[model samples]
Each structure stands twice: as C-alpha cells, then as structure tokens.
Target: MGILLLKLVVGLGNPGKEYERTRHNIGFMVVEELARRQGVVFRKMFWFPARQAKCRIGEHEVRLVLPTTYMNRSGKAVWGAMKKWRAEAADTVVIYDDVDLEFGGIRVRAKGSGGSHNGMKSVLEWLQTKAFPRVRVGIGPKPDGADMIGFVLGGFAEEELLKLEKVVERAADAVETIFSVGTERTMNEFNQLQIG
Candidate 1:
C-alpha cells in the first residue's frame, strides 16, 4: 500500500483535438485535473512524446504526463519520461480507461497484467515488468452487441457528461490519497463508491 512510491503519473490516450474528452481519454482527464489542482499546465516536451507538467502532491514532487504517442504506443512516452526521471516500473502510476466496469467505477491496484488494454500492454512491454500501480477508470458495459472500438472511442452520452467532472475529481483525489495515506487505505476509502 505505502510502497508504490511513484515518481511518474502517466495518463494513456490518443493525442488530437477529436480525441479530447472521449471515453478513452478519461485518463487524460484525471491527470489534467491533478495538474489543475497543482496549478500547473502541461506543455509539449520535445525530449519525450508527451505533454508534461511538474507538480508536488503531498511531499512528493510528481510529473504528470499525457502521452502524445497515441493509445497503443503509450509505453514509449511513459518509458521516456521514466528514463528522464530515473524511475523504474514500480515508481510509476498508470491511469487509463477500462471497458470492463460500469461507468463511474474505479479500480486501483498495486500491480497486475495489462489485461486487454493495448495501451497498458505496450507499457508492460516497454517497462518489462507488471509491478507498476494503475488506476483504471471505468468507461464501460459497451452496450448490447456494439462494436468495442466504437464504444470506447466514442464520447460519453449527454447524461454521463453531466457527472464527468465529478468522476475525474474523484479519480484525482484517489491519486493524491495514494501519495498521502497509502494505496491500501486509499483503495479502502475509494474502491466501492460509484460516482453519479
């Protein structure tokens, strides 16, 4: 719980105007909220494939990253930032959308396989380990017989959009809590609540 001591917080998503706020970009949304809370703005980093901002959360100075390498190749950006920060796989936290849970659900784990997430798969491949912590924001249930790709890439429905900010805020809060309280305590406090 307390051991995830992270230096980098990466949000996986495809970079482009059209992709903004889409279901898959919820990871981006969470990091953006974290940046806002720290009063920092993300700027293009030529040295790496991402927009980065430096911010202090609790006692730890963490780098918030939004990968510009697109979803599937997110590992490239994350790995680059990890190298820049001299961080290992365990010293990073990955936040991404998961279609397996209902919308508003969030799952935080210390370590696990990438599962069916291509972006996470790429991260695992590049990092050569599955020991990193991750925050999976729910984006799912995919609708009856709908195309998985279309559902994830699509924007939230009008109703869901109403509560989007709150969900993002909750996710960001969970992250800060991880830094402050510890992952286990934070998970115990946050895991069961479904935001409206």
Candidate 2:
C-alpha cells in the first residue's frame, strides 16, 4: 500500500487561564479532549501556541493542532501548520465556537463561508480559500443587551456547563468521523444531533 497522507486537525482558541472554560474557547476544549482520548500531550511551539501529536485512526495518519494565537489571529497558526505539512484544504479540519447556533449544538460543513467568525476569517485570509472542512460548536446567542465579547469569553453557567461536556465529546467524535467517512457523511450524522 502507498504511504498515507498527513491530515491536519486544527482547534482554534485563545491561550491563557483567563480564557479557560469560556464558551469561545470550546475549540480548545474539544482539542484537549481529542488529545486525551489519544493519550497525547500538547507542547508549546515557537511559531504559535500549539500541541503536536501523531496518531492513527483506522488506516489514516492524523496530526492534531491546537492554535494558541487566540481567536482573531488563529489563521496564522493554522496556515503555518498547513504549509509545514503540505496538506491540502480537503485534509484540513478546523473546530471553533459559533454564536449563531443554539447552545450545545454543532454544525459540520465540508466547505463554505466563514459566517462572521474571526478565527475562521483569519484562516480563510491566511489560506486564501474556504475549501476546508469545519466543525462549529454552538455556544448560543448573547442575552438581551449583553456584551458579545464578554459573553463569549465568559465560562458557561453551572447549568450550561453540565451540557458542555457532552457537546465537547460529540464534537471530537464528529471530527473522527469526518476523517474516516468524509465531511458529507460526518455532517449528515452529526448535524441532526440535539443537545439539551
């Protein structure tokens, strides 16, 4: 059999204790869960805040990355990895939090517009394309008159926190399915999943 190509899975989030457990940092949480499942550890990289790991799921070789560039500047790290790995857009998957969807929900897209996500916007800007796959984790919309930034940066309330774990785990599973079965299959299987 020919050698398998390397796939890059990027989880976008800010790096710091202040942002930990925040709705916006759900990308980081999902990546952490992915690492934990694979028994891998994240280490700091000079070019970007990242943890690198090599793992095999079935017959495919995977490299998981968690960008430490925070949100707005996430593309820099993502592009860095893409170039380093020589991976194509089809082989890249980006996971991030989405304010447009309901809490504890997820949407997987094979390729589409960024839809006002700064982290995704950055990735598109750096890569110069929107052909990559993305898994969007819903954090829900802001309450009446609430500061959007504050809402995203703030951790989930006790009630929401209870449901967040299930969301994260599901996100990780969706990602694995994306790699194994392709984006279209993963989307069909995961998009209909409801969380309460």
Candidate 3:
C-alpha cells in the first residue's frame, strides 16, 4: 500500500481550566501526551488563539495543535491553522471524543460525518470537507436520563481516571501510527483495540 502522509494533527477541546480532563477534552489530552513524548512545547500563536508545536517523525514534519477556541468555535482555529501551515485536508488528522462507545474504546476513520459533535461540526464546516482523517476516542455512553452537556463536561471519577490515562496513551500511539503508516492501516490496527 502507498504511504499516506500526515502533516498536522488537531485535538478538539474547550479552553479553560474547568474543561481540563473532562471527557470532551480527551482530544486535548491525547495531543498533550504526544507533545510531551516529543519533548516539544506548545507555543501560543499570536495570530490565532491556538497552542501549536512542530516536531519531526520519520521523514515528515508534523504539527500538533490544540485550538484555544471553545469547543463550539473550534472550526475557525482549525481552518486558520490549515491556512497558516498550507495544509491539505488529506494531510491532517483530527482527534476528539465520542460518547457512543465504551470508555477507552477507539475508532479511526479515513472520513465520515461529524454526527452530533459540535466540535467536529465546527471543524467540518470550517474545513469545507469531511474527507479528512479522524480518531474518535470513546468517552463512553451518557447515563440514562442524564443531560448530555453535563455528562460530557463532567470529569472522570477517580477510578475512571486510571483507565482514562491508559486510553490517552493509546490514542497518542494511534496518531503516531497514522503518521508512520497510513490512516487505513491505523484504522485496521487501532479500531479493534480495547483499552482501559
């Protein structure tokens, strides 16, 4: 199979201390893990309200971005990063949380709908395409009769945090696999993973 290159990875999350470590911010967690492993720092770009860092993996230069925009407004930052870095949709990967699966479960797709995710909707709307790759880290299903927003915004319980730590690690590994191989191989390898 031909190698599919990647130049940028965007992690979707809200900006603010309160949102830190929340289920919805798993994207941020994964990217932060990648940055730490790469020994790079996330610098705030003055032009756009996002934290970004550049590092090399294999023969490709890759960028890691965490949009400072609140989750609902994430598209603007993503679109801005693409323009600033001159990145094509094909060379970018978006990572975010999905509530439809069990916690720590991961699903990677080459391209697909945003479903009801506001952050993804914003990204797809701003990018003007759904043809980009994405890594959906499962945050588990919302409890019956629970408010969706509250469920997503809530932090993991003490025990769940232990499991989440492993999930975050695996999610970061999935991103690296995408860079080393291709999204198709990443999907096949990671989509079957059951972490936690």
Q: What is the TM-score of candidate 3?
A: 0.95
lDDT by residue for model 1 (1-196), tens? 2443347999999899999979999999999999998899989999989999998786777999999999999999999999988887776889999999888998888889988999999999988888888899998889999998898899999989998998899998888888887777878888898986
Assess each prediction's global lDDT (C-alpha) against the native.
Answer: 0.89, 0.87, 0.91
Q: What is the C-alpha RMSD of each candidate to the true structure, in Å?
A: 2.9, 1.3, 2.7
Q: Indicate the residue-level lDDT of 97 in model 2.
A: 93
Name the 10 consecutive residues with the lowest summed lDDT in model 1: 1-10
Alpha-carbon TM-score of each model against the true structure: 0.95, 0.95, 0.95
Model 2: weakest 10-residue lDDT segment is 47-56
Which pairs clash inside model 3?
none
Candidate No. with top lDDT: 3
Residue-level lDDT tens digits of model 2 in 42-109:
77777555667777665677888888777898888888887877888889989999999998888999
Model 1, which residues run further than 4 Å from truth?
1-6
